[model samples]
Target: MVYDFDKLWNYNKPADTEMAFLKLLPKALECGTDYHLQLLTQIARTQGLQQQFDRAHHTLDEVEKQLNTQAFPQAAIRYLLERGRVFNSSGNKKDAAPLFEQAWQLASETGNDFYAADALHMLAIVASPEQALEWNLKALHLAENSADTRTQKWLGSLYNNIGWTYFDMADYEKALALFEKCLQWNEKQHHPMEVFIARWSAGKTLRLLQRTEEALHTQTGLLKEMIDKNMEEDGFVFEELAECLLQLNRPEQAKKYFAAAYNLLSKDIWLQKNEPARLSRLQKLG
Candidate 1:
């Protein structure tokens, strides 16, 4: 039975989809064609997203062995981009940068603006603060000018990264503005997930700006949307709402959300490692 891999991926359940790919590997091998190479690339990407870096690299190595770059230029670009993503996620940005650069050059030469913008956006993510904005803006330009729906879909992510680069540089105003830009694009795409993510960034930036009232409004709306969508497992939004409630001197409301956040966060090991302090504070709120 052939699986609709794209549909599986779009379900946003990467771990399960990756497992499905693994189970299908035997059937994929039976076909014994370059098409399996593309399937391997998809599996590698899911592994990268799961932070199974070693496994991802192994999968990518198989793709490299089978890839006919002359015939599959787009797949070549995908390979480079996925390899770069794995390296970047693993904190080997130096290794990642060259891959992204190669992808950018290849995509540009192929006149594939979608991939060109993707490669540039990845380069922006790994670039230093001084260069990140420039790379991001270049990607943004391609995304803005392109007619491809694929490039248009990238708008929210490009704006979100630009906003974070500004945030990291402590340019709160620019960060807030760019996050707003992300939401506008997300709305245009009718992508609720990206809109919520952009709202989270905007809300956090508002808090940093000491615009607590605005933050409160943003968090309230975000929390409502999340709840309505039954996406309460996203503990960060709960935490954001709680923080805003705390600032508004509503301890009772804040405590409930803090507890909710803690409950959800405890199940996420990545969040546990990245936000130890937040977890600690949430405990105290109880």
Candidate 2:
């Protein structure tokens, strides 16, 4: 098969970006692409962005096949990052979890601040509170030592997410402190999405602390901005906003937001791919 005229015959049809990459993979070694692992990952991400998990995995398969022959060792961090993301986005945490573990070890071993921070950020999200706090702090440490703007933005969001985790654990003071740090870092970086996340978390933390007046006002303003930005249609953001409203003794407003969330999520055909198991839940929400 290695010497065949068309070793990747099935992939030659170019039915999709994944296949095109697959077809060229055999000769990738002969060419100048040491980043084929990254290439497979890039294509997979494009598929993932399109919400096509099956295609993303199919591309990942090609990457695994190429690695079996001889992989470019330096690209492992990027490869694992993409692999973890594909697994996570597809809701296969069981499968995705190991990728994060691998990525964490690889990044630490290589002393790559960017990849290390990213790996830690991902691991923190799925970890238990104790473990998450450890990872989040490590990510913060790495970001602090790096001069990369992108790393700062990611670290800021990680802080906010860590704050959220603590909030869920009913540690309002810790959540508020972490969220304040998140806001400070994000403000310096100027990332609006991270700012939004920070604000939402802040409102929640404030509500948990019984700062109802502040929470209500902040959330009200944030909701208006979300609506204006058209982000009210995002299921996740809608859920966040709804939680805030519900806490403010505004169940009716919460229901309206949840109903809108249901409507937005019901039409999410993108998530439908490779997620039939979620359809029932989506339907219930709808």
Winner by TM-score:
1
Each prediction's TM-score versus the true structure: 0.87, 0.72
lDDT (Cα, tens digit) per residue for candidate 2, span 1-286: 2322223323212246556566666775565455556666667766775667788788877777666223455466767877788888777777777888888887777666777888888888767778878888888888877887656656676778788778878899999999988888878877787787787778768877988678767777776887788774456556555666776677777776667666676566655566555544434433
Candidate 1 per-residue lDDT, tens place, 45-147, comes to 8998887999999999989988888888877888999999999978799999999999999999998999999899999989997699999999999988989
Clashes per candidate, residues 3 or more apart or on different chains = 0, 0
For residue 226, what is the lDDT in candidate 1?
Answer: 68
In model 2, state the lDDT of residue 39. Answer: 62
